[model samples]
Structure formats: C-alpha cells, structure tokens
Target: MLIRLLYASRAAEAVTHELIESILSESRSRNPALGITGILCYGADIYMQVLEGSREAVNKLYNEITCDARHRDVTVLHYEEICERRFAGWTMGQVNLAKINPSLLLKYSERPVLDPYAVSGLASVALLEELIATASIVCRP
Candidate 1:
C-alpha cells in the first residue's frame, strides 16, 4: 500500500548549509532506492518533511528520523494511505523557507515561520500544496 507521512522537527544545533546538504545528499541517494519521494522544508531551526512511498518504507524511515541525532522534538503531522502522490517530481525536493516571502508563511500559520507544532496537519499539507503551486521547491541541493 502507498503512504504519505509528514513530520516536523527542530534542529539539535545550528542550521547550516552543510547540515542541510548532508541531509539532502543522503535523501537523494537513499530515497530513490527505497521508492520514497518527498519534499523537505527548513528554516528557523525547523524541519518539515513529507515522505511518500510504500507503507513499510515510509514507516521505517519515520522511525529512523525519530532516532536521528541531528534533530529533536520530532512530531508527526500527517500520515495516510493515498491514491497518488502530491509531491512526485523528485526523489527528494526541498524548500528553503527563509528564501520565501514571509507573507507566504503567514498565509498558513499565525506567524511567518514553520511551526508545524502549532498548526493542524491539514494546514501544513495546504502549505505544501501552496509551495508546489508557487514553484518554490527545488530539486537539487
């Protein structure tokens, strides 16, 4: 069965290009082999990612993410069996929230930041859709 899993976490330390690159590199390498596709959004020491793939693969990856040492306060925002992927253009696409206009963020949440912890999972998903519509997500690191 195909599944979609969305989760958010706060960086354990400073958010740097190296750290983001490292994560993207790993995702680009490993996700394709595992049949996972998704988008990653990062800013304000926050990370919000969505993984789409087979149920087992998505679940295992979520478990691994929860145990990863690079981030803390991992929280699942959404998970469901889906008929099709909302993000299928790349093995792992990315959005640098800092690079987007703060007004865009305000459209979804109270403030201009990625605080998935404070919003409904559906609201977060809506933000992802908006990102797709605006062509804000990048495929390469």
Candidate 2:
C-alpha cells in the first residue's frame, strides 16, 4: 500500500537549496531500495510536500521530515492506499516555494496564525486540481 502525506511549513522562502538537497539526499540514501518519491511546493508563506512510497517507507520518511528543523506546523493530508500515483516520475522531486500556486496557498491559509482548514488539507485536493489547471493554462502561449 502507498501512503500520501501532505505537510505545510511555517516558512515561505526558508526552504533553501541546501535544505532541499539535504532532504533529497537523506530520502535517497536512507531508503535506497524502497523507490520513494515526492513533490514539494512553496507558496508565499507556506511549504507543502507530497510523499509516496510503501507504507513503512512513507511513514519513516514522514517521521524523519517531522524531526527536521527546516519545517514547522506539519499536517498530514489524505493518506490511503492507491493503485496509481500522482508523482511517480521522479525520485524526490522538489519545487521551490516560489513556483507553487499563490491562490492555492491563499486558499490554504490567510496567514500563518490564521489558517483555515478549507485550504490545504483533504479538501485542498480540489484546490490543488484547480491550481494545476490554472497553472497549465497560464503556462500556455
């Protein structure tokens, strides 16, 4: 079974290259055989990441990430078994906080101290789909 965890970071631009590199390296090095994969997004003041793998591997990865200093205010979203993967194309794929959809972030939180559950949680998947579609439209010439 595959597990999916959605986490939000308290810092917006706090996710540095060094931090990303460290996460990627650790994820790959720690589970060289599990074939884990993920994607990261950063909005104005939050960081969201999706991790997928075997149940044990994904849980372990989540534990490691929670202990890391680079993140704060972590939240899990939509964890369940799936026959298909939304991010199976890369090994630890990470996108900087700047590339994420601002509207999605806005939907997720009005501000750090004022987070509304409707933005980036289980219900946020709908927002994510909307953002992706909007992004795809914007990227077109």
Candidate 3:
C-alpha cells in the first residue's frame, strides 16, 4: 500500500541556500527511482517534509533521514496509508518559507511562522496543501 509520512526536523546548523539546493538536487535524482514524491518546506532552521511512496520505501527513507547528521530532533508528524499522492507531479517539491506570503503562514499559525512541531499533523498537511494552492511557484524543484 502507499503511505504518506510527514516529519519535522531542526537543521543541525544554519542551512545555506547552496546546501538546500544540493539537498533538492539529490532528492530529485533519487526519489523517482524509489517511487517517492514529496514536498519539503524549509524555514527558521526547520524542515517540514511530506514523503509519499510505498510503505517500505517511505519507512526506509524516514530512517535514513533520522540518522542524517544534518537533521536533529526529527519527529514524525503523520503517517498513514493514502489512496493518492498529494505531490505526485513533483519528485521533490520545495518551498522556502522566507519567500512565502505571511498571510499564508498566518492561516496555519498565530505567529506567521513555520513551526510544525507545535501544530497537529492534520494542520501541517493542510498548511502544505494551502501552500500548493496559493503558491505553486514555491513547489517546483
């Protein structure tokens, strides 16, 4: 069965644009081969990612991510069998929160920030869906 796993993690340190680009490049190159499609949102030194794929692939990837040195305090926000992929078109969609509209952020949180750790998994997913609807530009690789 297919599954969608959402997780949040803090960057080990300040992440540079170059680093983010490299991460996206690697994901773009690798995810398709594993049947993975997802959206990765980065802001305020935190990452909120939604990965959709076969259960095994998603679980394996989540394990690898938790062990990666770049991430710390990794926390799974959501995981469940899904009938369809929310990010099917993109191998690895990306959003830099700094570029998103504050109004969009305000819809999800009181402080207009990307703090997935403080939000429910359903809310996190809804926030991502809103981002896709309002700012498709940010979802491109």
Question: Which candidate number would show the highest TM-score if scored against the true structure?
Answer: 1
lDDT of 3 by residue, 33-126 (tens): 9999998899989999989999999999999999999999999999999999988988998888998888888888777899998888988889
Q: What tens-digit string does per-residue lDDT give for candidate 2 at 1-141?
A: 876666665652465667657666775565447767666555445566667788888888788877767667777766777787666654555544355445655655664322423464765555445544554212100
Q: What TM-score do all the candidates reach, one by one?
A: 0.98, 0.67, 0.95
Where is model 3 poorest over a 10-residue stretch in terms of lDDT? 132-141
Supply the TM-score for candidate 2. 0.67
Whole-model alpha-carbon lDDT for candidate 1? 0.94
Clash totals in order: 0, 3, 0
Ranking by TM-score: 1, 3, 2
| CA shift of 44, model 1, Å | 1.2
Clashes of 2: 3
Give the per-residue lDDT digits (tens) of candidate 1, residues 1-141.
Answer: 899999999999999999999999999999988999999999989999999999999999999999999989999999899999888787999999999999999999999888999999999999999999999999973
**Residue pairs that clash (backbone atoms under 3 angstroms), model 2:** 42-97, 107-119, 108-119
Candidate 3 residue 3 Cα shift, in angstroms, is 0.3
Q: After superposition, how far is residue 73 of candidate 1 from its true place, in Å?
A: 0.5
- State the TM-score for model 1: 0.98
